[model samples]
Structures are given as C-alpha cells and as structure tokens.
Target: MAEVLRLHGVRKRYGGGASPVVEVLHGIDLTLAAGAFAALVGPSGSGKSTLLNLMGLLEAPSDGEIWLAGEPVHAAPDAARTALRNRYLGFVFQFHHLLPAFSAEENVLMPVLAGRGRLSADDRRRARALLERTGLAAHAHKRPVQLSGGQQQRVAIVRALMNRPRLVLADEPTGNLDTHTAQEVFALLRELNREEGTAFLIVTHDPGLAARCDGQIHLQDGRLIEPDGAGVVTAAATAPLTAQ
Candidate 1:
C-alpha cells in the first residue's frame, strides 16, 4: 500500500523565550499507509494532539519533516502548504464545527465550495451520496440546530470527505457522544474506511475504541513507544530516540 503520511524525526517545541523551550514531540518517526485505520493512544501530555496537528497541516513541526500524500511539507510556502492541506487532508474534532446557518448538505459541501469557489454538479451528487450513506439524506436541507449531536457529527464526517482526502485526522471524534452514539459514529468511520480506502489516524483515549482499530500507536511524554509485533504499546522507553 502507498504511504498516505510519513513523519521523519518530527519534533515540536513551543516558545524559545527566556524560559526553557517546552518540547512536545521528540523526533517522532511515523507512517500511515493507505486505508490504514489506526488509533493514537496516549496520556494527556503525550503529544498526541501536537502530532495530529502537524499531520493535519494545522501546525508546523519544530525540527523534522512531514510528507503527506508524497508531498514534502516542512519547507513549503504558506500558499502551497494550504493548498496541499486542503487537497490531501481531512479533519474531525470532538466538537462538531458545522456552520449553524447552513443546511446539512451545504455543510457537507463546505470544503468543496471553499476549494473550488463553487460546488460542481458532481460535487453536489457526492455530498448527497455521503449524506445518504450516513442516513442523513432526509435531513439534507435542515440546519445544524435541527439535528441532534450525533447527526451533527455525521454531517461533520461527510464534510471532511467532500474533497476526498487521502488521510483523515480525527481528534477525539467520539468524545462528546453517548456510548451508543459513539459506537455508531465509530462504526460509520470504519465503514467509510473500508468503502473509500482512506487512511485514518484517530486520537482516542478509549482503550476499547483503540483496540478495534487495525493498529495502535502508543505515546508517552511526547515519544512513541516501540511497538511489539502486534502493535501493542509496551513500556515507555527511557531513551530519547525514534524508531519505525
């Protein structure tokens, strides 16, 4: 399978002031292959969100390289990076950030509209198809306020796929939902992974949820723990190093 994302010695640090620099990720080496559904499991300060932000093009790494869909991004210009981010990456968050004023279908077409200035006929068709797949077809013209939390999240998921991104970065996507709703949303994401072959790197604290993925990446204190053959997280390594 083609690699959808790769990180080479990626590191993240904040504020090089009179105070000591606070580093979040330490020379992280990671890769996500096409269609791979993986969970990023870590404690609160383990740099999971920092790593996901880097991969999703929302933040730059302190001292490493990131390649998304084969495009090197560490040194790209802002415009180029933004273009690549829009074209190759999709994102979901714990809170559904749907536009309150827009209808469900309009919310789903947001990415397409933002990228192309307008939605094409094919784009509209694809949006409806995704809505249908998510069981939101009948609510296409309803605003976000008309939908429940789970339904809003379903709309958010469809919006992420509007541009057909190769990789989706989900940060606690199911965090705000009830158990049943979370399960349904997680199942929907997995279903899309199977049907569309899009790689997903989901940051989750739920061990049960992580176990259901194809593999799990474990992190502690901003470093990835070397996984055994089964991709299960072992003990936290003391060495400040990165390994494949």
Candidate 2:
C-alpha cells in the first residue's frame, strides 16, 4: 500500500518560554498507509486532537516533518497547506456540521464545489452516486433538518469523500450517535475504506469501536506509546494526557 500520511518528530508547544510555555506534543512519529482503517485511542488531553489538527493542516507543528501522499508538507506556506488539505485530506468532526440550508445532495457536493468554485456534470453525478451508495439517494433533495441524526452524518461522510481525498481524519465521527447508530456508521466507514481504498485515522473513545478497527494507536500525555509485541496498549499507557 502507498504511504498516505507520515509524521516524524512532530511537536507542539503553546506560549513562549517567558510565559511558562506548555508543551503539548513530544516529537511524535506516526504513519498511515493507503487503505488503512485505524483508530486513535486515548484519554482526554492525550494530545489526540492536537495531533489530528497538525495532520489535517488545521494547525502548524512547532517542529518536525510531515508528509502527505508522499509529499513533504510540514513547512509549506498557509495557502499551500490549505490547498493540499483541500486536495488530499478530509475531516469529519464529532458534530455533523452540515449546512441546514443546503439539501443533502448539495451538502455532499460542498467539498467539490468549494475546491473548484463550481460543480461539473461529473461532480453532480458523483455526488448522486455517493448518496445512493449510502442509501441516501431518496433523501438527496431533503434538507438536513428533515433527516435523522444518522442520515445527516452519512451525508457528511459522503461530502468528505467528494474530494476523493487520500486520507480522512475523523475526530469522534460517531461520538454523537447512539450505540446502534454508531455501529452502523462505523460499518459504513469500513465499507467505504474497502471500496475506495482511502485511508482513515479515527479518534475514538469507545473501546468497542477501537477494537473493531484494523489497528489502534494509543497516546498518553502527548506521547505515543509504542505497542508491545502483542500489539496491546496497556490501560496505564492508553490514558489521555490533556483535553487541550
């Protein structure tokens, strides 16, 4: 598989030394291969969100290297970073964040339209197909307010895929859903992973969801503990270090 994302010695620090700077990440190294379906699990404040932010180009790392889709990008300028993220990285947060004013199909095309400033005939067809794939073709014309929580989230997933990103970073994508709904969403992500061969790095607190992933990276106190030969992240080592 291709290497979609890689991080080397990435670190983040807030405030200056004179202001009692607080270090959030400690030069962590990580990677995600193509078609990978992995979970990031840790307690709150473990720097999970910070890590995701850095990887998604939402925040700049204080130091180290980042490569996405085989290109070195940690030092890229803001505009370049934004372009790269829009072209190669997708994000889904805990909240669906769907625009209530837009219909399901329009929301699904948000990324595409946002990137190109307009949609093509092929883009529309692709959006419709994605909705159909997620069993939302019938709801394509409905607004988000008219859809259930799960359906709206499913639309968000389709929107993320509209750009055909090499990687999708999901921070608690299922955290807001009920147990059954969470499971369904998880299963859907897995299916898309297989079908599209797009890599996914999901941050999840649910033990069952983490276990269901192909692999899980555990973090504690802004450090990524190397898994042992058995590939288990011990409870002590898996606890989150910070909520910030």
lDDT of 2 by residue, 119-170 (tens): 8999999999999999999999999999999999999999999999999999
| RMSD values, in order shown | 3.4, 4.3
Candidate 1, residue 101: Cα displacement in angstroms equals: 0.7
Q: Candidate 2 at residue 53, lDDT?
A: 90
Worst 10 residues of 1 by lDDT: 228-237
List TM-score per model, in order. 0.93, 0.92
Model 1 stretches astray by more than 4 angstroms: 228-244
In order, how many clashes per candidate?
0, 6
Candidate 2 colliding pairs, count: 6
Alpha-carbon lDDT of model 2: 0.86
Worst 10 residues of 2 by lDDT: 229-238
- Which residue pairs clash in candidate 1? none
Residues 99-132, model 1: lDDT tens digits: 9989999989988877889778999999999999
